[model samples]
Each structure stands twice: as structure tokens, then as C-alpha cells.
Target: MNQLEALKRWTTVVADTGDFQQMEQFRPQDATTNPSLILKAVQKPEYAPLLQQVVAQGKGAEISALMDQLIVRFGCEILTKVPGRVSTEVDARLSFDAAATVARAQRIVALYRAQGVDTASRVLIKVAATWEGIQAAGQLEREGIHTNLTLLFSRCQAIACGDAGVQLISPFVGRIYDWYKKQAGAGWDEAAMAGDNDPGVQSVRSIFDYYKHFGIRTEVMGASFRNVGQILALAGCDLLTIAPDLLAQLQAASGDVPHKLNAAAAQGMALERVHYDEAGFRFALNADAMATEKLAEGIRAFVADAVKLEQLMQAAAV
Candidate 1:
């Protein structure tokens, strides 16, 4: 079997893209979309019709509502391809507003439902892993709206997500790797940090170990992988949302994809259970410079793309 085939035996591979056309070939069990990805897709000539259709239908509705509809449209298309689920992210601008985040998430779910989607099973409302976001997810979960907490970069975030009883948590792998590598500058040793020693890989591993040890029911889906190595290192995660290029590389490569992360082994380790309240969560997140910076940077990047997407919609409306 090719590496992708081998990896699937242990992990549920998810396509991390707004371009649903790319998903059929990879046969990802699930798919994930963010504002940036949606923005990227709508800009393509082939996807132009999708944007125009949404704009034409939305008419004079608020841009925010139209944005939600567009993403839900993408999610609905993605769902037709993947059998399991599709994560549609909330607007990153509401990352810190629990009430607004919850309201927006409910609206997104309502849009999906209007299209006959089984929101509880076939959709995951993706939210940033802010304390407020987690709290918002907890509220959504209570209402039977499953959530995928995204932009998570710390164990504290993971812990909080688990506490929130979220359906899943996407701890970014590549972004963490990027931050550490950039910080190391000249002292970075690629050879030593390539595989198991990779900081990003280690971060997911630590979160995985903790979740397994505590029997946390929230699934961990490692996202934002930079290369095949990071994906391979996390072969046994609950799920790994990978870009199409890396998925293609794995599909082309021939090798044994090892089950690198073992739940039983994680459970065997001596790990203390950790929980975080609002203040504690804030303090913990603030203490981790990498997590703090990346979380903010990720939110800003997504918000910028969301704005760009709105601009495209406005132009299409005219």
C-alpha cells in the first residue's frame, strides 16, 4: 500500500481545504474550510460561479449573513464528497466574543440545516480556541451542534476544549513548527528537529498523551502541517487535516506509515490532569509566547481573508 493507504489504517485523513474538487481524489473521510481557504477558492475561475450564485441569491442581505451562507454552501458541497463531516469555521472576528460567536455558530448551523444537512453528525462548527470560543462551543454542544475548536496551540487550550466537551480540537502542527524554527534562527538544526524531535510534532504528541491519559472525549485533529514528515510523525492521531499537496505526496510515496502515536502508551505515561478556568486559561495562554503569538496571528490572518472574501462578494454583487 502507498503511504496514504497505510496511514488511513490508523488515522482518519481529512482534507484541509475549501476546494472540494480536490477532495474526491484523496478520499478524505472529512474536510475542513476556513475563511482563507474559502477566499482562495472563490478567487479561482472555476469557483467563480459559486461566489456569484451566493451573491445573486443573497441580494441585499447583510454581508456577515452572506459570508455564513457562502461558507455553508462550501461545507454543503464538501459534505457531498466526504462521508464523515465538514468543519465550517466561524468568523474569526468574533474569536473573543462568546455571545457573538455562539450566535454566529448557530446561524451557520441553521444555514447548513436549511440545506438538509444533519448538523449534529455531518457538520462541525469550527471556532477559534479562545476561552470565549471554548465557552461558546460548550453552549453549542449543549444545543446539539457539534464543534471543532480550531487555532488551538497549547495543552491548556486542548484541556479547555476537552472540558467544554467539544467534538474535536485542531491543534496546529505547521504553525507551531514555523514559530519555533523562526525563533531558533541560525541555531536551528534541521536534522535533529525533523521527525519525532520536531517541536510541532512534540506539541501534538503532548496534547495527545494528555487527552488519552485523561480519557478526554474531544477528538484531536492535527492541522496546518508543513510537510509529509509532520503528518507521518502524527500517524495515529484521531485525525490529521492535511493540505492537498502533502496528501498527494503521501499518495505518491511508497512506504510503511508507522503508527507513531499509541493511545495505550499515552495512557501508560505519568501525566497529571490539568484544567483551566477563565483567568487561569488566559494566564497559561499568555505564558506560552509561541501559542499567544500564533493564536493572535492566526486570528488576524483569518479575519483579513474573511474581509477579502467580503470584498469579492461585494464586487460580485455589483
Candidate 2:
């Protein structure tokens, strides 16, 4: 079997893209989208019509409303191709505002519901893994709105999301790799940290082991992978949201994709459960320079793309 097929034996493969047309070939169980992906998709020739359609449908509505509508439109298209769920991210600008995050998530869910999609089962509101975002996710979870906590970069972030009883947490793999590699620079040994030893892969492994050790019910989905090796390392993660490029690589490659992670192995490993209250969570996140820098950078990047998306919508409205 190809690596992609081998992966399906141990993991639920999720296509991480806003390009719904590209998702059908891989046949991923779920799909994820962020402002960056959506912005990229809307600019594509095939997806330009989708943006124009949402703009046309919401003529005089607020730009933000139309933005939400566009997200749902892409999500609705994705839902038809995937059997599981579609993670629609909340605006990154509201990442630190608990109330605003909750409100936006609710509105996004409502938009999905209005499109006749089963919001409860098929939609996951993607929120950044900030303290406020986690708190907001907890609130949404209580109301039966499932959330996927994204931008997660640390064990503390994962623990807090688990505590929030979120449906899933997306621990970014590639971004962590990028930060460490840039820091190491000339000192970095590519071969030494190639696969399971990779910092990014290790980050997800640590989070996965901790979650399994504590019996945390929140699913762990490794995200933002830079290569197929990282995905292979976390072969038994609850889910892995792979970009279309990486998914294609996996589909074409034939190999024995071993189960590198499993609850049974994780439970037996030596790991301690860490609890993080709000203040503790903040301090923990603050102490990790890599996580702090990357989290802030990730939010800023998303916010910038969101603005660019708005510009595109504005032009389309005219």
C-alpha cells in the first residue's frame, strides 16, 4: 500500500485546504481551513467564483458577515467531500478576546447551520490556542459546539485545551520545526533530527503522550507539517491535517508507514500530567520563547491574511 493508504490504517487523514476541488482526490476524513488558505483559494481562478458568489449573496451585508458566509460556503463544499468535519477558523484578530471569540464562533456555527450542514457533527470552530480562546472554546463546548484549538505550540497549550474539554487540538508541527531550525542554523544536524527526533515531530509526540497518559478525551491532530516524514512519525495520532501538496506526496510514495504513536505505548511511557490555570497558562506560554514568538507570529500572519481577504471581498462587492 502507498503511505497514504498505510496511514489510514492508523490515523484519520484530514485534508488541510480551502480548495474544495483539490480535496476529492485524497478523500480525507476531515478538512481544515484558515484565513491564509481561504485567501489563497479565493485568488485561484477556479475558486474566484465562490468568493464572487458569497459576495453577490450578501450584497449590502457587513463585510465581516460576508466573510463568515464565504467561510461557510467553502466549508459547505468541503463537507460534501469529507465524511467527518470541517474546521473553520475564527478571526485571528479576536484571538485574545474571549467574548469576541465566542461570539464569532457562534456566528460561524450559525452560518453553517443555515446552510443545512449538521453544524454539531460536521463543523469544528477553529480557535487559536490562547488562554482567552481556550476559555471561549470551553464555553462553546458547553453549548454543544465542538471546537478545534489551533496554533498550539506547547504542552501547556495542549493541557489547557484538554482541560477546556475541546473536541480536538491541532498542535502545529512544521512551525515549531521552522523556529528551532532557524535558531540552530549552522549547528543544526539535518540527519540527526530527520524523523521522530525532529523537534516539531517531538512536540506533537510530547503532547500526544501527555494526553494519552492523562486520558484526556480531546483528540490530538498534528497540523502544519512541512513534510511527509513528520506525518509518518506521528502515524497514530487521532488525526493529521495535511496540506494538499504533502497529501499528494504521501499518496504517491509506497512504504511501510509504521504506527509510531498509540495510546497503549503512550500510557506506559514516563510522563507527568501538568495542570495550567489561567495565570499559570499565561506564564507557561510566556516562558517558552519559541512558543511565545511563534504564537504571536502565527496570529499576526493570520490577521494580515484576513485583512487581505477583506480587500478581495471589498473589490468583489463593487
* Index of the highest-lDDT prediction: 1
At residue 48, candidate 1 shows an lDDT of 95
Best by TM-score: 1
Q: Write the per-residue lDDT of candidate 1 for residues 70-138, one digit (tens) a residue.
A: 999999999999999999999999998999999999899889889999897899999999999999999
The reply for model 2, stretches above 4 Å from the true place, is: none
**What is every candidate's alpha-carbon RMSD to the true fold?**
0.6, 0.8
lDDT of 2 by residue, 63-152 (tens): 889999998899999898999999999999999899999999999998888788888899999999999999999999999999999999
My TM-score estimates for the predictions, one after another, are: 0.99, 0.99
Q: How close is candidate 2 to the true structure, as a TM-score?
A: 0.99
Per-model clash counts, in order, read 0, 0
- Colliding pairs, model 2: none
